[model samples]
Target: MRGATAWSSPIDPMAAEFQVPVYFDYLATFSWALSGAIVALRKRCDIVGVFVLALLTSVGGSILRDGIFLQRTPPVLTDPVYLPLITLATLLIALLHQHIIHLQVVDKLVSTIDAIGTPAFAVVGMQLALDAGIPLPGVILVGAVSSVGGGVLRDVIVREIPFILQAGQFFALVVLLACIVFLVLTLALQVATVHAAWATIGLFFVVRTLTIRYNWQTRPLLRDEDH
Candidate 1:
């Protein structure tokens, strides 16, 4: 019974102390769900497909981060808010599909929303890993997975290559760099504050947005003739 009390504790100190991160986590979920729903619409999928993509895009990375990496219950199972939010996103997208499809800015808007979510999730994952006493590499891995895992799953499910594998946009690189910067600031430099976390997020958002706006891309490794 020595460790029983610790195991049965009802409140997690980390969860209670970080209200802002929790709020941003849910916001990221909604943003990611919206992106997936838009993709579903682009594919001419029905309402059910939209729901599936939304759910997957919103929670898929967290599922892997928690269930597979951390060996804990997935947040989608423990948190009641995720499903309702995803459902709401699906419904809203369905309602606005006609107008959304016609808007020339739709692609840019979706990309921006997705970019907003990436750094938030990356910070969340880094904090969680640090709290769990994971090592530096594991922390970075968790952060990267939390940021891009869901999008990768969404793309794979839709039969498209994952964005990270594509030679452009610095998408996955942004997540990795952000995570590394966060770990350096908070762990190595001993600056343990939410502000540091937000700084990392801001850096990621700006760099990612600039890359998108400028059409920056990694140089292609193989030319058509070389291949």
Candidate 2:
């Protein structure tokens, strides 16, 4: 409980009851929206398409995880803040598309943002599943889904394969590992705190960065033609 006080209280209780986790959610949403917008611009999508993709990438995972999987209304549908945040992200991307597209650092920026968001969303999903009293496997599933489902949806919309199913990157695996680590710390060790969540996010970011740097990949099964 040492670091708990630093994260508990909202500055404006009347205006919004935003907590630390909600802040994480907002960060993840913004990062994913930016990535989606970049992809839309890369694909030569119209402004409408860019906005749609940004919205989908920002809130799509939460919708699938909470609404479809958990059988409840998603926060994006109910929360007033989320829509405005995504709208702002979309408009920023629209205005800066020309500059962003020409930048050599765009890929790195997207990858870094995605790396940061994935673990945050994964921890959020695990926390929700734990609060719902879901089983261990269910918690892990929801966590992974919450981390990558939006990116998958965005890629599918643009006719590209989901990054999780692709050959190179251990992106989804990092999310799963982060979920397991978080649950182990909170449930098994009984150390549930905001610090634990932050630790999980840090671990995930380190692992993901190493994976990308080393070009680590999941091994594929042998093809039929090999026989």
For model 2 the local lDDT of residue 98 reads 79
Top lDDT model: 1
TM-score of each: 0.90, 0.88
In angstroms, the error of model 2 at 133 is 1.3
How well is each residue in 1-227 modelled by candidate 1, as lDDT tens digits? 01224333432535522833677788889988988898899998999999999999989998998889866688888878899999999999999998988786877776786777888888887666666666679879998998888989999999998978888766777788888898788767877658777788789889988997897888668978897
The ten-residue window of minimal lDDT in model 1 covers 1-10
Off by over 4 Å in 2: 1-20, 223-227
For each candidate, what is the lDDT? 0.81, 0.78
For model 2, residues 1-227, the per-residue Cα lDDT tens digits are: 12223233421221211223577678789888888888888889898888899989988998998788866568898779888898888899899887888886977887887788888888777666655656789889998998889989998989887877876767777787788888788777877457778888899889989998998988656666887
lDDT of 1: 0.81
